[model samples]
Target: MNIAEVSKKYEISADTLRYYERIGLIPEVNRNKSGIRDYTEEDCRWVEFIKCMRSAGLPIEILIEYVTLFQQGNETIEARKDLLIEQRKQLIEKMENVKKTIERLDYKIERYEQSVVTKENELKRTDD
Candidate 1:
């Protein structure tokens, strides 16, 4: 596969892929005889993984670190695990905060509805 094919398969732009490579977020891609990018199955798989992690709100800096550790062979496995765990913890905390905000919004909406009803009742009494 080429860059175009990889881009279409991952729903990512070619420019973004190049940017990832340039930023060291991903390994440098191989080139063909004409110097065009020659993406392999492994490359596409890594792109998909990176996209998924990014969409899940993982920071690019952390991803770059992870990639660096990955390039250093298997000795960095523990560090990689620690990084993922930390991100997961942060994501959970953010989710909890969102839930609290949603609850507050729901309470405010209920109070507004009650106020509207009370005003309607007062208007009806005044008309009597």
Candidate 2:
């Protein structure tokens, strides 16, 4: 597919796709004779993987390292796995923190709800 088609399909802008290619985040795309990018299935897969990793808060530097290792053939398998594992560990820590924050917010909201109910009850007593 062309750059425009790939951009629309992946929900990414063409400029971002170009930047990814330039930054080595994704492999270079094959260009047609007219100098238009033609994205193959493999290219699309790379784009999908990069998008998922980015959404999960992975940094560009880490991703570039991963991609570099990936391009170095089978010898870097362990290194790639180690990188992913470390990132996963960090992501888990972040998730735990977010969970704690959610719990605290829930508790605060419940307290406010209880206060409102108490105030309503006191108002009723005064009315009677």
User: Which candidate wins on lDDT?
Assistant: 2
What tens-digit string does per-residue lDDT give for candidate 2 at 5-124? Answer: 999999999999999999999999999999999999999999999999999999999999999999999999999999999999999999999999999999999999999999999999
lDDT scores of the candidates, listed in order: 0.93, 0.98
lDDT of 1 by residue, 15-123 (tens): 9999999999889999999999998888887899899999988889999999999999999999999998999999999899999999999999999999999999999
Worst 10 residues of 1 by lDDT: 40-49
Cα RMSD of all models vs. native, in order, equals 2.0, 1.1
lDDT of 1 at 88: 94
> Alpha-carbon error at 43 in model 1, in Å?
1.1
Error of 2 at 85 (Å): 0.7
Cα TM-score per model = 0.84, 0.94
Task: Give the C-alpha lDDT of model 2.
Answer: 0.98
Off by over 4 Å in 2: none
